[model samples]
Every structure is written in structure tokens, then in C-alpha cells.
Target chain A: MALIGILGGMGPLATVDFMEQIIRLTGAARDQEHLPMLVANLPHTPDRSAAIIDGGADPLPALLEGIDLLNRNGVGVIAVPCNSAHHWYAQMRAHSAAPLLHIGEVCAAAIAPQVTRAAVLATRGALSAGFYQAALVARGIEPVLPDREPQECVSACIAAVKADRPGAAATHLSDVLDALSAQRIDAAVLGCTELPIAARELARPAFALVDSTLELARETVRYALARGWNRPV
Target chain B: MALIGILGGMGPLATVDFMEQIIRLTGAARDQEHLPMLVANLPHTPDRSAAIIDGGADPLPALLEGIDLLNRNGVGVIAVPCNSAHHWYAQMRAHSAAPLLHIGEVCAAAIAPQVTRAAVLATRGALSAGFYQAALVARGIEPVLPDREPQECVSACIAAVKADRPGAAATHLSDVLDALSAQRIDAAVLGCTELPIAARELARPAFALVDSTLELARETVRYALARGWNRPV
Candidate 1:
């Protein structure tokens, strides 16, 4: 399998969560059987949500630096765990030597197979950017976004998880999911990386949950493993 | 703060555990407040335990390659999550411009503050190399290693974790700890990275558990945070 690269540290904990998901999904019995990963946890990058919503410092330079290092080290495929960072995806991919996986595309593809209507649980910046929305629309699936109140709930939830408070975010998350279930939503896309951590605290929700982080990981693994066995012994 | 670097993926999950520990210890409430980390999750490097005890392929070249990448990328301080890999610590540190944190030294230092007699729960390779043992002795502490049967138990526990079976390893790990407690052991250093995951399955053993992965992570965070803030404004 080709070595996988992760441009992470959008929020350090989310990056860790993404890596854990990849490890879990790989189901490798031996360390060597697991897909090799090179994770650039360069978390000091300016906040993507803040940058897009409130004119914060641009995180593009830092993102480029991380991608360049991964490329220089010869990673075969790269994936960024942060959804908000995908606002600069095209630019980052254009500059990268390796292919970068699109979180939205993967999540949409995963969703298209099963549900027609799904709620997008994401950062306000990512919601405003409409990447996941556009991807689902292109696939002819309806993408439901959090309303202003629910968006505030998501923002608070993400902030709590960033501060290492997964439990604190659970109540608000449950309320958001309850609202979605009321709308007869078929599933919810955990479009933001941090949302998945908060989702863990909830007892299986009323609707199916499509985890964007896990989907990206699953896709990354499939993409890498599919790249032909290491040129045979 | 200086950028922190982790030479990880000796076993990918252990590496993630180490990163999570670092994040937890940093107490960062926001993305920027967290230490900037560059993690090289390059698991394709030959197995450290096999390389050591079985006379398998030397992992020195691979270790050095990963270290060199960290140095090249301007990480101010480096730490390795894998205890067994410390067999080549001196050589790896020698090849890099950045300082590599010693898992044993940090672990022993953390242990010295409270305990005098500590158990070293590690792979056969690490015990044979005597890195943890020597560090404890230098700190004027007694290092208790597993006897032949206990060593096999420790190995089995580590294998179970590597194979993603923490529950299956819990019984044997408890037995090993019970034996250590019989000898008046005050603490046990989880010298193998995988052992920490297995240790989690046990409900606080009678003796203290000194996790080498967590110790290394704490040291790394302290190292980077103390490195004189990234050139004041």
C-alpha cells in the first residue's frame, strides 16, 4: 500500500481523532499491516473558521508548508482532516505534488449510496462555504444545514471539544440531532471534524450519522491500498 | 514556543495515544494555544522488537531517515513514542540537529519524584537493552523487571494490543501486575507503547502505572513550551 499523508493540526484533538478513526477502520492485526501514515500536526495555523467568518489571519501559508513537507517526504496520497480548511482545498491541491482527498466529495459519495436527505453538521465557515452542500447537490441528495440556533450550538460544541470537553458538548449536540430527527432527516453528516468527538457521547441518534472524518479515512485507506501492492517482492 | 516533533508510528495507535496525551497535558483551550506538532507516523520502518531480539533487519537507517526529516523541517525538539526504539536513541539523537527526548530518562525522572522501586513492563528487547533499567538505576531507584514467565505475559499483552485486542490482554496484564505488587513494587513503567493501551483495561492497579508514552509526551510539550516563544511577535 502507498504511504498516506495527513495535513492535520487544524485543531490538534480533531487530528488525533482522525488518526484514531483511520487506525480503527484499517483493522490491522499487526502494526506492519496498517497503512503507513505521515501526519503533519502543525496546529498553530490560524483558525480556519475565524479566518473565513471574521477576517482572521490567513492559514494558507502554514497549510502550504505542511503539504510541502509531506510531498518532500514522498507520501503517495494526502488527506486533510479539517473541514473548514477545505475552503483552501483547491489552492492547496494545486500546490501539492500528491493528491489531496476531498472530505466533502467522500462524505457525499458515502451519503449518496444510502440517503437522499442528510443534515450537515459543520463549522459555520464550512457551512457558509457550501462545499459539502455543493457536493451533495451535485449527487442529487438534499443537504440540510443547521439553522442559526443550531449553528450556534455546533460552534459551541466544537469549541468545547477543542478545549478537551467532549462531555460538555453532548447536550447541545443531542438537541441539534433531535431537531434534525424532527425534520425527518434520514441522516446527519458529521461535516466538521470536532463534531464526531461530541457525537460519541450521544446514545445512537434517531437518524443515521455519516462521519466525514471516518469517511475520509475510509476513502484514504481504500485509495492507498488500491494503489497496487508495493511492487511485489 | 518551539515546534515539537514526534518520530512515531512504531505502532500507529500508540503514536496517536502519545499525541492525545500531549494535547491533554498542554491544556490548550484553542487551536493556537496548543503546541505545534509535526508527527512522522512512518510505520513502515522495520519492527523494533523483532529487529532487536530476533536479529531482524536493522531499523537504524529507517529511524535516522525519519529523524533527519524532522530536523530538516525545523522542529525544535523531538520525541519518539516507542520505548523499544530507544535502543537506538543515542544514535538517532546523534544524527539529528534537534534534541530527541529519551523515553526512559523522562519516565525515570517522573518516577523518581515519588517511587523508589518501580516495575518495568516492557518488551523483551527493551528489558534486554536495559535502557529503562539503567535510567532508573541512575535515578537511585530500584528497577524491577518481569521474570521469565511475567516477561512472556508482558509480551502477550503487548501483542494483543498491537493486534487491537485490549480486552483480551487485560487478564494477563492484571496477573503481571499482581505479581509485581507481591514484590512491594511501587510503580510500573509501561515501557512498551502498546502496554499503555492494555493498562487502560485495568481499573487502577494496586501499584502506580507510569506510562512511558505519556511521560515522553509530557516532556515534549514542556520542551517546546519552554523554548522561548516563537520570536516575540
Candidate 2:
């Protein structure tokens, strides 16, 4: 299988979450059977949401530097776990020599046939950026979002997760999902990578859940397995 | 802070655990304020325990390759999470340009001043190889081991964790720790990196517990912080 490059540390916890998911999804009995990965957990990279939606400093140069490091270390495929960062996906893909996997597209595909209308719980930046909603629309699925009041609640929950306060985030995230359920949404997409950290407490909510991190992990394993199959027998 | 290199995927979950600990230990409020890390989660590297204590294929060459990759990517210090792998620490340290963090030494020091007689729960390879035990002994701490029956139980628990069966591993690990408590051991060292996954379930046993992975993470953070202080301010 090809070496996987992870462009991570958007909030730190989410990066570890993504790596753990990738490890769990792989069907390896021993260490030598699992895929090789190079991870640049550069927590020093400027915030993606702040840069794209808040008119904050651009994170592209740091992203490019991470990609360059991954490339130098021999990663063949790159994946960014941050949903808000998809706003810069095109630019990152253009600058990267390795193929960049789209977390939003993968999540959209997984939820497309399962639900007609889905709500997304994400950073305010991801909500404003529209990559997730755009991907869902492309798949013929309607995306639902919370009202302004509940949207702020969603943002607070995301912030709590980023700050490593899973207990507080769980309560706020539950409220955001409850608000979406009141709108008759069919499923909920966990667009922010950090949201999955509260997944156990979420209890599947009142609707089906589409976890972007899990989808990305499954996509990564599929990519690695395909490469392994194509290699000389 | 300096770029920390992690030579990981000795068991993929342990790598994630170590990374999570590092993230938690660092004092950062934002993404850009955390430490920078380059990790080679090369699960494809041959089994360290199988190579060292079992007279199986050597893992040194693969270990060297990972270190070389980290070096090329500009890592300032290297840390390996696997306890059994420390049998090769001297050789790995010799082959790399970056200073290697000895997980056993770090754990031993943290445990030495706290307990006189500490039991170790680890892989059969680590128990036989003696690096962790030797480190503890060197610091004037007496090391205790479970009899063959409970020792095999400890090995089974480690294997279960590596295989991703946390529920089963937790049950077995609890049993092993119970046996040590019955022997009146003062403390316990989680010598294998994977053992910490069941740590919460063990409830600190009848004595204090030293997590080698947590120690390594603390050491990694100290290394990065020290480097930051030394840089031109």
C-alpha cells in the first residue's frame, strides 16, 4: 500500500481521532500488515476557519509546508481531516504532488442514498464555507442547517471539543442535534472532525449520523487496499 | 517548540495514544500554539518483540528507515512508543542524527521516587528483554513480575489490545493487575505501550500506576519546550 500523509493538527484532538480511526478501520492482525503513514501534526498552522471565513491570516503557506514535508518523507496520498479547511482544498491539491482526498465528498457520498435531508454540525467557518453543503447538493441530497440561535450553540460545542472539553461539548452538540431533529431532518453530518470525540455520548441522536472523519478513514483504507491489490503478486 | 519525531505504529493504536497524550500535555489555546510533530506510523515495520526476544526477523533496518524519514523531514528529537522495542534503543540511537527519547528510562525515573517494589505488566518480549526492568533497578527500585501463569495472561491482554479487542483486553488486564496486588506489590508499571488502553478500567489497581506511554509523552513535551526556551527569544 502507498504511504498516507495526514495534514493534521487543525485542533490537535481531531488529528489523533482521524489517525485512530484509520488504524481501527484497517484489517491488520499485526503491525507489519497495516498501512504506512506520515503525519505532520503541525499545530502551529493558522486556523482554517479563521482564515477562510473570518478574514484571518491565511493557512495556505503552512499547509503547503506540511505537504512539502509529507512529500519529502514519501507519502503518496494526502488527507486533511478538518472540514472547514476544504475551502482551500483546490489550492492545496494544486500545490500538492500527492493526491488529496476530499473528506466532504466522501461524507456526502456515504449519506447521499441514506437520507434526503441532512443537518450538519460543524464550525461556523465550515457552515459559511459551504463545501459540505455543496457536496451534499451535488449528490442530490438537501442539506439542512440549524437556526441562527442553534448555530451559535453548534459553534460553541465545536470550540469546546477543540479545547478538550468533551463533556461540555456533548451537552451542547446534543442540543444542536435536537434542534435539527425538530426541523424534521433525516440525518446529521458531523462535519467538524472533532465532533466524533463526543460520538459515544451522542447516542445516534434522533436521526441517522454521517461522521466525516469515519468516512475519510474508510476512504483512506480503501485507497491503501486498492494500491496493495494492484502491486505485483 | 522544536519538531518532535515519533517513530510509531509499533502498534497503531499505541501511536495514537502517545500522540493524544502529547496533545493533552502541551499548554496551547489555539491550533497554531501547539507543538509541531512528524510521525511515521509505519505499521509495516517488522514486529520488534518477535525480532528481539523471539529470535525472529530483525526490525533494526526498518527502524533505521523510519528514523531516516523523520530526519529528512526535519525532526529535532525522536521517540518510539513501544516498550519491547527499547531493546534496540542503543542501536536505533546510534543510527539516527536526532537524539532518541528512552521511554523506559523516563518511566523508571518517574516511578523510582514513588515506589520501592513495582510490578510490570508487559509483552513477553519486554519481560524477557529486561530494558524496562533494568531501568527501574538502576534507579534503586525493585521490580516484580507475575508468575508464569499471570505473565502469560499479561501477554494475552497485550495481544488483545494490539488486535483491537479492548473489552476483552480490559478484563484480562484487570486480572493480571489483581494478581500483582495479591502479591503485595507497591506499584505497577504499564511497560507495554498498549497496556494503558485498559488503564482506566484497572482503576489504578491497589497501588499507583506508571504509564510508560504517558511518561514518554511528558518527556517529548519537555524536549520540545526546552528547545523553545533555547531558541533566540
Candidate 3:
């Protein structure tokens, strides 16, 4: 099995969820069978929106440092659980010697086959920054964004997730989904990992909801298995 | 107030724990009053111990990329919650424009007046890498490490933490505490954040335990307040 290195703490809950996904997906019989791992959970990062919109702080340097830590440790591959951080994925990939598994690309690839046009429900910063839009467009998929009011609500939902308020976060996500439905979008991508927790609750039979996080987890498992990190039982 | 940027996901659980600490420690009512946060949880970091001890892969470039992400976003301060990643603190600090908060320094600062000679109970990688020793020495304090066999046990405990075996992990910490008692040490430092969760269960009235994570939390709160991020109660 290959050693796994994790750069996390974008929001503590999301990070834990990602780890749990890895464990569940790997289905290791014993603790030793689980992949050897290294984690750098730095929670002192400034607000992503504030950094981008208000000139507050950037989280890229700490992220690169974490990648370097993992690279120095000789990890065969690496994965980051944060969505917004993908904004700097190009620069990060340029610096890393080992292959970096892209959460956005993985997620995009997963839902691409299911929908032709999808609306993104994420933070305003995510939309304004063109993080996921560019990715979707590159895949020949039409990207729809939440309107201003809904965008603000999406930001609030992300904030609620950071504050550990799952209920309030879910409410915010529902509001965004409503807006997406009003726009006649085919499906909605939970661009923010936090959004999925709420997205699941708001999911309906008519609406196709895509969770980027879950997709990333599945992709990671496929990557690890394909690379011989785990032999198929 | 200066924005705090986090580069995390050393392990998802630890990252969430750190974020909880930040939220709990901060005295804020509204979301905006709380310090703005930017986080990039990259779980794809290469294994630190494997790379360092077994000649696996390098983690430096990934870490630097994280830092650069935060830097480009304009984060004034950066912090990484993973104790092992501090091994390259000097290098990361030198490379980034933002000052990276030192978890070891924060730990040392918190415990300096409380204990004179502190025993370190941590992962083999952390102990072998001299992360705590270097921090303690800089502060004029003596660090006591566990003996060989127990140290191996401590490493096993850390591995348990990575494996998400809380009970086994705690038992390993308890065993290490017993060894510290045999040495008649004044106090034991939960050098690894995972160790504290375990240490708390085994703590006795006579034994003093210093938790680097809790100390970092307190320090982070102070930093936020000092910078006027928190609204006055």
C-alpha cells in the first residue's frame, strides 16, 4: 500500500469527513492494512472569501508548505480535501514533484457524464473567482451560477458549515437549490464540500444533485487502487 | 485584525479538532466578527515519517504551494496544525511573505512558566525529528523523551491516531505516561495533538499534562483578540 499524505483543515469537519470516506472506501480489514498517512491540519488560515474579496489573507502558502512536507516524506501521491483551494491548483501542481490528485477535476469528471448543464452552488467568492466555472467550461459543460441574493445565501451556508451549524447550512443550500430550479438548470453541483451535507437533505427526486466531495473520495479510491496502493479483494 | 490562513489536512480529524478550538476560543457573536479564515485542506500530502525515515517522498514543495496560495490571497498570518510539519518551519517561513505561526513555539510559550523540565510523549517521527527539542531548547527548557521501547510504543500510538483507533491510541499514551511516572518527570507534554485526547483520559491529579494543541488554541484566540478581530463582549 502507498503512503497517503493529507493537507487539510479548510474546515475541520470537512477534513474529518474526507478521512472517514477514505477509510470506508478502502475497506481495510485491520488498522495496519489502512494506508500509512501523514496529515498537516493547519487551521490558522484566514477566510478564503475575505482574502479574495476583502484583501484579508491567502491560504496558498501554507498549502504549498504542506505539499512540500508530504513530498519530502516521499508520498507517491497526494490529495487535498478543500474545494476553493483548487483555485491555485495550477501553481501548486507546478511546484510538486509527486502527482497531486485534483478534487475539482475528479469531481468534475464524475458528474460530467450525468449532466450537460449544471448550476454551481458555492460561495460568492468561488463564483466570482471563476474556480469551478473554468473547470466546467473546459469540459464542454455549461456552468450556471446562483444569482446575487442566492450567492450571498450560499456564502452564509458555507459560514454555517464553518460554525458547525448543519441545520442553518442546509437551509442556505435549499435556498440556493430553489434558485437553481427557478433558472431551469438541469442539475446543481455542490461546489463547496460543506454544501453537500445540506444538499443531501434538500435532494428531491426531480432534481439531480452532484456532490463534489463524494465524487472526489470515489476518485481517490480509484486512483489509489489503480496505483496498486490496495489490491482488489 | 490580521486574517488567519490555515493550511491543513494533516489528518481530517485533527484538522476539525483545531477548527473547533478556533471557534470555541474566539469570542464572537456574528460570523463577520469572527476572524476571517482561509483554509486549503490538502489530504494528498506524502507521508512525513515514511519520507523522512524510510526515504519515501519529499513534502516541501506541497507545503510551499499551500503557503503561496495564502500569500497570493493576501493572508497576513499562516498556521499549520500538524506538529510533524513544523520540522520544516524555518524553510517555510523563509519562503513565505506571511509569518507562519509556530505550533511548537506556541506550545513552548504556553508551558514555559508552568513546567521546568517537561517530558515529551509523541510519535517516533516527531521525537526523532527533534521538533519539540528544538523548540524547548530555544526557550531555555529541558526536554525529556521516552526511552527506546516506550518510544516505539508512542510511535505506535501515533499510528493508531492516523488509523483512527482512539481506544488503542489512548492506551498507548497511557503506557507512555506510566513510563514517564517511572522516570519521575515533573510533567508530560502531549507533543502530538492526538496524544492530548488520549492523555486527558489517563491524566491523574498528580501528573501535569501540557497540550500543544490547546495551547495553540488559546494563543490563536489571543492573537485574534489582540488584532481586534473579536467584538468586545
Q: CA RMSD for every model? A: 1.9, 2.3, 9.4
Q: Which structure is stronger by lDDT: 1 or 3?
A: 1
User: What's the residue-level lDDT of A212 in candidate 2?
Assistant: 90
Tens digits of per-residue lDDT, candidate 2, A208-233, equal 88889999999998997778821312
lDDT of each: 0.84, 0.83, 0.70
TM-score for each of the candidates: 0.95, 0.95, 0.55
For candidate 1, write residues A1-233 as lDDT tens digits: 45688998878888999999888877777777777777888777888988898999999998998899889988888999999999999999999989999998998888746688888999888988889899988988888887888888888888999888877788778888877776868889999998888899889887889888889988987887677322211
Instruction: Give the chain B TM-score for each candidate.
Output: 0.94, 0.95, 0.89
The TM-score measured for candidate 1 stands at 0.95
Residue-wise lDDT of candidate 3 within B1-233, one digit each (tens)? 44566776565445556666776677443343555555545545655666667776777887887788667655667878778777788889999898788888788777746566888876666777887887787877789988998887788777776667778887887777777787765667777766665555564735688887788777776776787755422
Candidate 1 is graded, for docking, as: medium
* lDDT of model 2, residue A230: 19
Answer with 2 or 3, whichever has the higher lDDT. Answer: 2
DockQ-sorted candidate list, best first: 1, 2, 3
The positional error of residue A84 in candidate 1, measured at the CA in angstroms, is 1.2
